[model samples]
Target: MGTPELALQVEPARWLGAPAPGGLALPPARAGRGTLYAPRGVYLDDRVVVVADSGNHRVLLWYGWPKADHQPADVVLGHTEFEAEGPGLLHLPTAVALVEGRLLVADAWHHRILVWDDLPEGSGQPPDRVIGQPDLRSTVPNAGGSPGPAGFYWPYGFTYVHGWFYVADTGNRRVLGWRGVPEGLRPADLVLGQPDAYSGAENRGRGVGADTFRWPHALVGDEMTLYVADAGNHRVLGFTPPPEQDRPADLVLGQEDFDRDFELPHVPQGPQRLRFPYGVALCRDYLAVADTANNRVLLFPGPPRRGVYLPAAHVIGQANFAESGENRWRAVGWDTLCWPYGVWGYQDLLAVADSGNNRVMIWRLRRS
Candidate 1:
């Protein structure tokens, strides 16, 4: 469930997969909350799914929702505070995905990546393929130095894009890549910030500010563009296809035009601005921003029909939800939403990683 232990360090995400109107039995009032803090990113397909329960020091696999919470997760990928097992376990599992028929985990705290072929089969807990630390050490781990394919440091976010894997190595201040992924999980081919950073101070050595990202947190890529929640930059940076060396971001949001500072906060006209944006995704053409600090999910409408060109339209929760301050949880029309950190597009429904309030919130998105 959503525990204060994890919250203080990682901010847990709520399981928003809803129960049938009058069907599934509700768990004990206390058991339904969430077990994440800064529960950052999520991914799903068919009957299998994964979550980066970051602060919790684990990754949870479900046989899909509705059936998810009720059943014990099909897999537990790390060493939880209370549970003991696995490949010495994970320090902070920030993101997860099933890639090329294999499981992928951004074992953030351990400074590496872990892979599994089955949900909870072989080894029961030990990862078959690991990328970060070679041995096991619990307290504040280190990557030694330059991550040579099998290494990473505070790799905060991850996703499988076009058979390749892209990682936001937060502590290292870079977006490291495993071109052809699952196949090339070693040695990053592309690096955004610096590489395999070992010290906190050195993280920003590359440069801080809008132009050069500091802590590039989460990522989401579409057919034509790649969107990054460039946390330190205080803006979302985008790049058109044909991404190349130092390929510039095509657009910026949260703050006014790039390179220029926003007179106010990043959340346009809202109660709180985004202090840290942890996750992002493209639902059709709409862009979803999990404005974590502000405790809200922001949406920018997708492009119009081929001929129509209505550019730059934004939408938060319900219009009635006040756009100011920290009361987003109690906003008139909101009814729900708390420290929401990550999001993914699911057909008509949007699966949200509602980190703080302790539950995933799925809303049926609509355009009018």
Candidate 2:
């Protein structure tokens, strides 16, 4: 596939959290509707926008796409109010998604997934169901026991596609999938990166391979293809026809091969290499990766063919493909990024969870 004829604006069209003005200093953590602190995940569409304000241990929601910078969120989750911040329910929510009108949150620190039957209209709305734990109040790694199909340990990201729900069970170093929004305490139908549900070793307790992950942080795809950001391995792995069970990936990105997982010394990196890539999203035919440690986002023309190393068509949050620095090794700017952790592409808009900068940016595709 070729790179699509698409371009993203150098600056975001709209943003939430941090003030728009650029600077070199890091912003302080604040709790309120218009502020964010080390946000780790984001979801966007024409109807709604969700941000995982991880530092605040809460999730913020805009009933609709915001029209201004630092717009206040319409609803708050994981807490009773925006200012009350003493670990109410969520320990550190890292991701959010909507499936069939239901809201799903990856309450990462608590090691569970929270599901709300419908979007809540107010703050502190408890989830209708919970996953990874036997009940809502029980929060433990692998349910305080060995790893299993139904347990999670720091499950940081997830997605719903083709009626199936997939989760990046990070601490377990694997991915778990269910046929649909599961009820309660039901085991996943499929597992990836491990020999069985009971295994949770990094790279299967050995070296890296096409079928193992060091840190499976985020994922996106459909029934045709799936992409996972293996952050700890510094690469993204692609699975064709969506793996039905543990299997080797059909493609690898950010490195020359699946066995290599080294992070090059801080310098200008080639388009084909990635350093701690943490997020992946598909926009039309293009793939957007949050090259986290590189402090930028890489956009591939489209899904590359089965190959070891593939180059990206464009780069965002930096001056060029060769530059890899947090805010370009200087002050923060509208076009710069600092350790972006999540990305979402819909139509022509790209939502980025700029984690290090404590903000979420919404960039638009530049029309020719």
Candidate 3:
């Protein structure tokens, strides 16, 4: 079947964290609902929006989608107040998600994931449970020892789908999964990229292949497939039936084959190649990938076929597929992006964590 055609607004419909007009020369890094600093992750749904303001070490939550640009968040996590800064309960949070109405945040520097049984209604609400550490106060990587299923080293991204939960244990060079919401520091039921839970070698200390990964950073999937952005390898891998154990991916994107991880020249390469792709999301009939190094996002038709060297059907954050410069190497504008780090998509809205731009841009998507 031919790929479905998709269209996106050249400019964002709404945005957050941009400086006020003529306010500052650079994007502000202050601690406030309307401000952000190098946000690396975002989660968007029909009614809510969440941003991992990574540089500020907090997560901002809007109870409802912001109706205007620079709308202040209604709640904040990881800090005591919107005006406060520095690490409090979170340390460089890199990702956020909502699972069955519960909140999950990847507190990357803390080497853990925090879960809230219920969504917080106000700022400073604490997580109900913790993962990857023995307690909330412990921040050691892999519990201060070798890699293991019960501990994590910079768990940067995660997703929950089909009653299963998965974490991109980035620092460990692995991905971990549980059958359900883990209650404590329980060992992961499945491990990928590495051979086993105790192994943390890059590409398993060998050449890159279908089963190895240098940096497994982000994940998104549906009931039948799971897609992972192996950033360090400069590709994305798709697993069918969401493997229950170590297995080679069934599909590869951004390269000619699984073994070749070479990046194309920095010029306007077509959509078949990727460089440091850090995020992936399934937006209805399309799969959106944050091609981080290219400063753009690629949209592939959904139900990604089992193959290598797949090409994207469309591109975002740039004027066309033949462009790959930050803000197109021009002045920042409503449609430009720089080093976008994360993406989350709902039915018709696509949210991008435009990290280098220090803002989240929400674009309207339409099918043709």
Candidate 4:
């Protein structure tokens, strides 16, 4: 099969978190005018666009589609200023999700998830609740250095769908789910990567298998399917109908089979391989993945409708799959990417968290 021909390009020259925006400019010594540093999380809906400004230890919220580059965000979370980084503030927050009038943040380094009921109107407001730890001041994994249903270590990303809440507990090599939005450190009703909720071992402290995960970093889905970017395992796992309890995934991408976790050692680079796929997004008939270490994003014309190996129909950042260099070994531009880690697609718009570039690139799919 020929390389899939789904063409995409940057939508606007105005990039979010850029320095031109007011109030959060980085110091002169820094590389860019914007304050973002290694940002890894992004969420977009009809009302707003939210980004986990990881390096700044803050989150930026834009109330609507930005009409120009360097537009200022409407709200800031975790700190009053962008340059400040401290405890009791977000530490490498990697994901953001808003549901049911509440804002959710995966404060990864703090080993907790923070909740804000009714989005804050400005900066420096504290969250209404904290999950994974007993309180906002405690950063201990599992709240005291042991694994249980309520604790988390480096929770990287999350999603809320159909009244259920999910988190990619990266450091623990698992995924946790709640029947609804969690109010506190309530025990997860569902767990993946181990036999039960209490186990936090890598790959369940066993060899690689179809049922285990090394680093499950992101979650995205609709009403019928849930996709996980299993970063450490270099693959994407798909669960049809979205598992309500611990169960084996029905579909796998980036490898020939569930047991094969190694990257392809040969000539061509194509859909059959993935190197640290850190994010996934599914739209009507499209699937996009942030192939992070590979410095590219892979796009499929349609999600796997069955359990089969389907090659990527298109690619972004690099001319083709065989090339995997940051900015394709050239100066960074709107068309290029470096270590891109998050993807959000809604309707015709697709947003990419271009981490190494310190900017979010929005693209629109070209109609055939």
The per-prediction CA RMSD against the true structure, in angstroms, equals 8.3, 2.1, 2.3, 3.8
TM-score of 3: 0.95
Of the two candidates 2 and 3, the one with more favorable TM-score, higher being better, is 2
Q: What TM-score would each prediction reach against the true structure?
A: 0.74, 0.96, 0.95, 0.90
Which 10 consecutive positions of candidate 2 have the poorest summed lDDT? 1-10
Error of 1 at 234 (Å): 1.4
Task: Residues 91-122, candidate 1: write the lDDT tens digits.
Answer: 66666777677777777767767777666542
* Candidate 3 residue-wise lDDT, 12-87, digit = tens: 6888896534322446778887899999999988767999999899999987878788888898888878988788
301-364, model 4: which lDDT tens digit per residue?
Answer: 6677447456877787887778888777766666778889988887877788888877787777
Q: Best by TM-score, which number?
A: 2
Per-candidate count of clashing residue pairs (backbone under 3 Å)? 22, 2, 0, 4
The deviation in Å at residue 201 for candidate 3 is 0.3
lDDT of each: 0.55, 0.87, 0.86, 0.78
lDDT of 2 by residue, 1-368 (tens): 11345543434788788684546886555898788999999998777999999989999999887978888898899888888664668988988888899888999989999999998888998999999999998998988889998989999999887877889999999999998878556999999999999999999998899999999999998767889999999999998878777799999998888898978858789788899999999875678999998999998766664777888887889878888988998897777899999999888888999999889988776644
Clashes of 4: 4
